[model samples]
Target: MRGCSRRAGRAARKRRQKCESSIQSVSLGHQLQYVRLRKFLHQRGFTSSLLQPALFTDTGRGLQTLKTIKPCQLIISLPESCLLTTATVLSSYLGQYIKSWKCRLSPLLALCVFLVCERHRGEASDWFPYIDALPTTYTCPAYFADGVLAVLPAGVRRRASEQRRAVRELHSSSRDFFGSLQPVLSQPVEEVFTYEALRWAWCSVNTRSVFMSHPSNNFLSGQDHYALAPFLDLLNHRPDVQVKASFNDATRCYEIRSVSGTVRYQQAFINYGSHDNQRLLLEYGFVAPGNPHSVVYVDADLLCDVLRGDRSLDQKRKFLKENNFVHNLTVSSDGPSWRLMTALRLLSMPQTLYRQWKAVLLGQAVCEEREEWSVHTAVTLCQRLLQDTNAALEKISDLLRQCDPAVREQLDVVQSLRQEERCILGRCLEALRGTVRQPDEALPCQPDDNDDDDAVS
Candidate 1:
């Protein structure tokens, strides 16, 4: 993990260079936007101990404390008036038209519509400063090029594809809704709300929105759903920092505070829940450096070695679903969850014993060969993990030699992810080396007998 100062310095240089490019004006305008935004907040009784949006390499734009802030101290307070929430939508002219359609537009989708309408409104849009401040480009894997996407771990690829489909669906739904209203409305479809424009709005909301609980509201329950916070959305994510963000009735503003003390000039980050890199890049367009929660999923095909044949594979998958054990096998900072262990055990066991094993799994009875089956499962799992870890190491070596900055940057992020995954796999292999050597037990898979520390790699 790079120190926060070092990471922040690197981010400053990248942003400075990016700012020197055509976005220079946008960065300059952002400074004034900060002034106006702070004034806007002040008028609404929103005040804090002087944290401002600053550049960082990992998070791009983020809030940095200008003064020492103790734990639980107020960071920033965004009034509900400043929040673009469900009520804001239901009350907007566009929101009213969508509501009259009698079709369900989720709060999130509705916010997407609101974002486009506001952006299209231009100077007529009351929130132009905030809208203009949003990045025209995103670094999220969802926006990764197809070639770049090809090299990502399977879980990230799957998520990026799903996000693409979801945004497409939302944009399609919204476009059709707006098109229906165009004849009765004054503006043309392309002028006000095109699919492309709506997609940009969807991206803004998707990447930056924060959770808001409007508990006492009548239109929507306080379900901890998301809402777009004007300036507050600029806060980036850091796994090491803890922040408490919620609506304070007494303050009547959405308040975010550092739960861990932050000193002058140190960037203050918020936890976007306990997320891994696959999730952060999928949603927020950036990855935290040295993210301990980085995880890699084992391809279910590994199970095919033991399960064998398409019929047996089908049965194994079906069995997992039926018993609610269907989870992608993962190796993370904490190593594999018990769900993966149970899955490996179930996959290696003979099909004939399933009838009895099902009962044993449900606490109905114990299998006589339970201990032996566990050893076999462990050996099989370790061997497979070793193979995967070695393959990833080879790929990591290949990524290191890429010359392009884009490819280089991608390499940096993927390298962090794969390295952590490799580490977990190595430790797992070590623990099972003894299990693999056990006598008189039928080995699930004969692993390479190499005992070198780097054998897994």
Candidate 2:
């Protein structure tokens, strides 16, 4: 009897455990059903087959079970009823949206949209009827002012306005991002300190500055007559690079225009900051065959290798033969020209020599009187390219004669003509002017004794 009771107790315990396991299994089914139902709601035309079976399976009994389904999934079984229910819910939640949509679909609104789109129609009939008619501007609540339409219907106006504003915001932002290059061009080179900063700063200023700073390190020397050619000036190198433009010509004056290809201006973009400090090298002579606009300099060596054949070694030879090729005349801190050093002074000193010249010409002084005179001296050198040649020569001669009549008498260098003797004389006058103007000016003349031995090298 004791064994029999123990066996019966064990059986009862196992049965209870089995019942609990079935209950937990059903709970798991409910979880799966929830996920399936949510996914169904998100789908287009999702109403029936999905929810009905899942709900019936989870609850194990419902009107959805093909019997008593008035309150449950069976409603979805009837397509028309399901759609009606959806419309009712949507109307309750967003009645304003529905009313606005209705207005847009109305005949009057359709006609207005058509007319606006047809305004530019070239056909006579398009505008013939309304050409002389006074445009009747409707006082309808615009979509711009309200979040819902308030044209008699408050919510409708506001909703329309909100949509319109959203669209306008998108359009404006896009316009700002993808608009023309004009705004970028108008920015000054000074605004961007480095080549990298100039990437987005427009092409004009950045390219010009780059050309000024990194011009080919070339200078022509012929006995007493030596000058920096504008050939490399056309290159317009950036400041970071140490090279400069160097070229020569058979003519007395350095002809920069010879090397300036029509498209050389476009090559300026090669040194833009955004382009990894790369330079552009353009070479084309085939289909566009030697077009001035087709010549460019790029930074990529691989591209250079690929287009190496395109690079006119023959043209380069021709260029060199026609014009004298010269050596690099890089001016260091200690150069012959005080004006050149002063122009570069802006790097160490915030005051620009150009600005100083403007002050002096206007009869103002930023530093010592002699230094102000030095500023004026600097301006004369820069103006040599454009100002009256003979007058400039006389001005220097007069200034030289005032200081040392003997030296002026010895070197009868006239600035009027392009000659070796004249250039040498002008240079001598420039040196005298510097010394007379600023006896105490700490001009970086020659390297000091304590300076490093390789200062010039």
Candidate 3:
């Protein structure tokens, strides 16, 4: 009975996994169709005002209503500096539909509304309910790097500009060799990058380095013991910039050592963009902070300890919860504890996450060191586990053929977890396989009424 139950559960789990995969593919197809229709409208020069799709409630409405009673609206979420470009693009392409956007909202307010509307439009795929009331417009000023924009309160706008200049001065005075380079921000975050212009800015004076970049074109500049390079910049901190770099006088450097690994230095640059334009530019570098003397690497265990105890995870959970998503239970502390971090990464797979949790609690699994591990470690782990389990299943099949009833029963339990690729099951299977013998003094076995059990024997 026990063996039969285990096999039944395994079959059910396999079926569930298969069902989920099918659902995902269907969802993806629906998304693609929606995107196609949206792009078609966009290419046809439908401005935001007139291009807004018919409300989900209005889907059945006739074309006459869409042409006449269809109210036009617009919203923008990016920085005010970005608004001119956005407005120009939409207004120019929209032509006749341009005048319909006269909702009399501020440039800043309009931007935020536009972003919210656009984002929510695709939430339900085909369903689009009317937004009877507009959401409150967020008017806080912000600063933009290549594509990354940092929001700022009205109070910080003035200080932000001053800080940007101060950062530039620090970089200009630095004498370090590699500290002079600047790297571009990674993709997607590049929206903050604009050709050139400074607007409302807040400078984090406490920031360690400076960065410079432009969105339209890839240009990276860092100074003040700060260095930024494109792809290299992605690798935490390792500076590369020759002398004669005008940003700073001397190269800057910082001590980097942590329990987890190297403590990469992160610095921000603040500089004046266009004084008349009222824009402040900030750049981040990973090298040295205010002081650069000699390089030193030490055991950064203390840093790691601080990270594990950090309350940032709680803050992040709150952020996600407020934003409508369920609280993300997984996070990595910037500490020496690889165990939690590793488990969290693996738990990203919803199907096997519960087993991962059990393993973590049991101390059977830990955060595997990946500093030296190749970038493909996660993918490799999944593939290897799959291959190994399949082989184990085949071996178990042979054991059953050999008429090893005890072995077959143990394999039955193992097979359930193996089929689902449950990590904890793998650990459990290995432990059981290593055990020399089952507990002794077995009770007399009960005889089954069915002859099937004896038939197999």
Highest lDDT against the true fold, candidate: 1
Worst lDDT 10-window in candidate 2: 277-286
Worst 10 residues of 1 by lDDT: 448-457
**lDDT, candidate 2, 134-169, per-residue tens:** 112211122112211221111222333553454344
Give a tens-digit lDDT track for model 3, residues 11-43: 865863454234211111124433554344344
- State each candidate's clash count: 1, 39, 56
In model 1, the number of clashes is 1
lDDT of 3 at 34: 37
Give the TM-score ranking, best first: 1, 3, 2
Off by over 4 Å in 3: 1-17, 21-457
Collision pairs in model 1: 11-57
Q: Each model's TM-score, in the order given? A: 0.76, 0.13, 0.16
- Winner by TM-score: 1
Q: Which parts of model 1 are misplaced by more than 4 Å?
A: 1-30, 180-187, 215-224, 309-316, 359-416, 438-457
